[model samples]
Target: MGPKIKQINRRLNELATEWNSFDLGPSRRETHSFVNSSDVIGRDKDKENIIDHLKEPSEDGNIPVIPIVGIGGLGKTTLVQLVYNDDRITELFPLKLWICVSEDFDLPRLLKLMILSVNKEENCDGLTVESLQTCLRSLLNDKKFLLVLDDVWNENRARWIELRDLLRSMDGLSQRRSL
Candidate 1:
């Protein structure tokens, strides 16, 4: 009975260690494709801007925050989507992460989404905002990540500040520049 209990404990430990290994999620090639953002119709300039920035991150390592700020229906999301799916840019950052921010930007939700975006198997159910932030800091502290905060409203300044603060906390994440 004692040996059986020890064997069970050893198996549990091995399973636990196995679970600790990172990333076990679904493939994203099935979704988040530029084809889904077909409504953007014509935004060649915007696509160019995104490409320019992405290119810098890939080739030159010097593209700024290239924000596509404008009123609604300007195809900001579509432009970014096109650039995101571009084959050239894909090879640049193999660690690509995409996050959606409509209006409300909750810290925990955003962090969990970011984690899941980067590491699909990341389980953030019991995690808090601080915990998630720490995880993001750990993941992005040394890595260069391109984040798209889509459809942000100009109304909520406080939430925006919080989100900005979290992003700013990242060391080498975003490089602010004009497009």
Candidate 2:
């Protein structure tokens, strides 16, 4: 009975931790790619490192995923903004798409956001996943592009793989980078 009680307590603690983590109260303000370079300070070295990585050729022929991870309020987004706005990045990838992915990782919603990033005027409200993929492929085909999926919080491996495979299906995305 004692061991069973301890096991139950352990399971309860795990459940509590999971619950607290998911009970995020307020919605975070969506982030954008634009930033005033003059206002940012002290992240030059980090920015340069990411830029160097981006400039390097992908040895594996896969779309390189560069994640800027840190605790909340630590300016991860700010550093990424600096990298995204850099002239070198712009020169390397002419077509840039920035999507603020907060919390939920719905595939159709993410697809719609990607489409909106490509063309803001696009009406993507009623489109299915197939349509969104087709449209995104049209915009990205044979073009050097950079996609920034910002503030991602999804932890599901299958969903991530689905998104990755979706990108992999595109023609010119083999050597592109996503941050």
- How close is every model to the real structure, measured as TM-score? 0.64, 0.83
> Which lDDT value does model 2 have at 116?
81
Which portions of model 1 miss their true places by more than 4 Å? 1-33, 36-42, 56-64, 174-179
Show where candidate 2 strays beyond 4 Å.
Answer: 1-28
User: What lDDT tens digits, residue by residue, belong to model 1 across residues 38-68?
Assistant: 5556676767766765665423433345667
Task: Give Cα distance to truth, residue 24, candidate 2, Å.
Answer: 6.3
Score each candidate by Cα lDDT: 0.65, 0.88
Q: Judged by lDDT against the true structure, how good is candidate 2?
A: 0.88
Per-residue lDDT over 1-179 for candidate 2, one digit per residue giving the tens place of the 0 to 100 score? 99999999999999999988998765856889988999998999999999999998877867799998888989899998999999999999888888888987889988988888778898888888899999988877788888899998878999999999989988866558999
Model 2 vs truth, CA RMSD? 5.4
Candidate 1's TM-score: 0.64
Who wins the TM-score comparison?
2
| Residue 7 shift from truth in candidate 1, angstroms | 78
